[model samples]
Target: ITLPLSAPGIAFSLVLVFLLAIGELSVPSFLRYPVLPVLSFTQFAASYNFGAATAAAVPLAALALLGVLIESALLQNRVFTFRSIGRGLLISLGRWNPIAAAIFGLLTVALVIFPLSALFADAFSLTTLHDAMQRAGASIVRSVIYSAIAATILMALGFLLAQLTRDRGQRLVNFLTLALFAIPGTVLSIGLVRLWNSPMTWFIYTTPALLILGYTAQYCAVTTRLSLAGFFLIPKTFDEAARLSGASWTQRLFRIFVPLSNRTLVCAWLAAYILCLRDVPIALMTASPGGDPLPARILTLMANGAPPMIASLCLIMAIASLIPLVILARVIPSRGITG
Candidate 1:
């Protein structure tokens, strides 16, 4: 049926949205919400007790892990395989098709385009934008650099793990990533602090590397899933033929797999980049003494800054999120990723 055929795409979308949702800190902080991420953040930020913060985060982490387990069970073979023989008859709208299309178009405009247009219209002003730039310029640059580093590391590690999806350790690897992904950023940041706060690892821990590691641990599974989708699309016969031709493993991977999977790798990188750029919880918790990422800085400024300036910063972040989506849309079509 069309439902089964489309399940993987739906599941992927759900996972992406879920990851972004559970890790969000700014909105919850702003709205005085009881969300898990905000709870963890307040516990540490207010009290400075790592143990109390981690304890508060444990239940939320468990819930997230359970969500992942449920998703894995529901989406197991459905996600990895796209081919199926069952077909459902298409219901044609016939004379109403045009009317339906028009309604859909209007709905899209009302929901996505209109809200964005309003945000831009209200948020844009030279003086406010300049103020935002002055306040957030360094943080923005840091966000980009950190995101790039995190995305690169995630894509590399994810590629290796994705290649081993059919191996014996796949389930264990998947479970580990899921568990890490589920852990509240505050909890993970505290764990990282405890592990690296020691004298030996202090150098890297005190640097931006800690933030990059947090991002990688949280989002690597997303990259792995994206890369694995591409890997699965490629027929095993290509590898078999290359092997028969006496090509080395490196030769096959470089000459064949990498070239074919280029689109997937790019998609994964862009995904990770956007995740890091918009992240607040990890950025807040893992930031160095004098430095904070743009998202975290924005959250801080929003409490005290003028509404216009805050709007402008939020607008920039919104645009940052949209850019990768546009790139993915264009690249996917050109690269023939039909799903």
Candidate 2:
């Protein structure tokens, strides 16, 4: 569960290295000078200085407060106001919990809102936003095309595989699907690279076709699983009825299964498309110079210390990722696919 959730982030980080490498080319001359070299030194010095000051101030403040309370008690010659102190402490503690919870909530909100705010803010900037939009526009278009083409191929294969198998081989097919899910994008990329590094596959390796192949391989199981689920939802009666009515397997599949499973088919395609769009590790590892995806492009900005541009690109990518999700949402409502 954790693996699936973290896979995207891990893949994002891996691709980010490549993005930064590209962004580093744009570093300003002044920042490249002595000021840049001293950054680490300044950070280290500030940490130690702040730590010492905080340490000294906390203890000193504590002692001063203790002394003040003691003096006040002594001046009144009242050894202690136990009841009053206890009531005040209880009141303070009662107030503190809600305040702390509010603060915690605010912090969490800020963690989410701030970065997004910064991204929007940066996108409004004339120069960086223009550059990001121009670059991202091209990359997004290419990636979408690549993903769509790959997903279509994967969906066809998955549908055929699902149609061919029955109870006896279903377990084996499912195990193979699960195996594909378990394989990391990096490992898949390596396998692809090895397979295509040969002379006969040289043209395939260097083209956008290679990236498509990698995506199809990675996401084929997703399509299979979705198609399988959709297939199961379809009654066996449809097939049997079609056969009794003099329909061949192909005609039955086309006339009944395909029409009835339209929603599932669309969903499977959408799922594969989303997975392909978000794919970073395999794309990054296997992408030829011509086939970089949007995620790969955003990482380039992050690596260059261009947080503003990176934020902007991230926001755009977030929206891009959500498109399929939005479609899925709209789709489910109409299809009666409920939780």
Instruction: Using lDDT, give the best candidate's number.
Output: 1
lDDT string, candidate 1, 196-267, tens digits: 888898887889988888999988877877777778888889999999999998898889888888777888
TM-score of each: 0.85, 0.65
* Candidate 1 off by > 4 Å: 1-23, 81-115
Candidate 2, residue 153: CA error in Å?
1.7
Residue 327, candidate 1: alpha-carbon lDDT:
92
Expressed as tens digits, the lDDT of each residue in 153-246 for candidate 2 is 9888888887887434655665455444444454455557667978898899988878888888767766776676677666788788888899
Residue pairs of candidate 1 with colliding backbone atoms: none
The C-alpha local distance difference test score for the whole of candidate 2 amounts to 0.63
- CA-lDDT, candidates in order: 0.79, 0.63
Q: Candidate 2 has what TM-score?
A: 0.65
Positional deviation of residue 166's Cα in model 2 after best superposition, in angstroms: 4.3
Clashes by residue pair, model 2? 19-299, 19-300, 20-300, 20-303
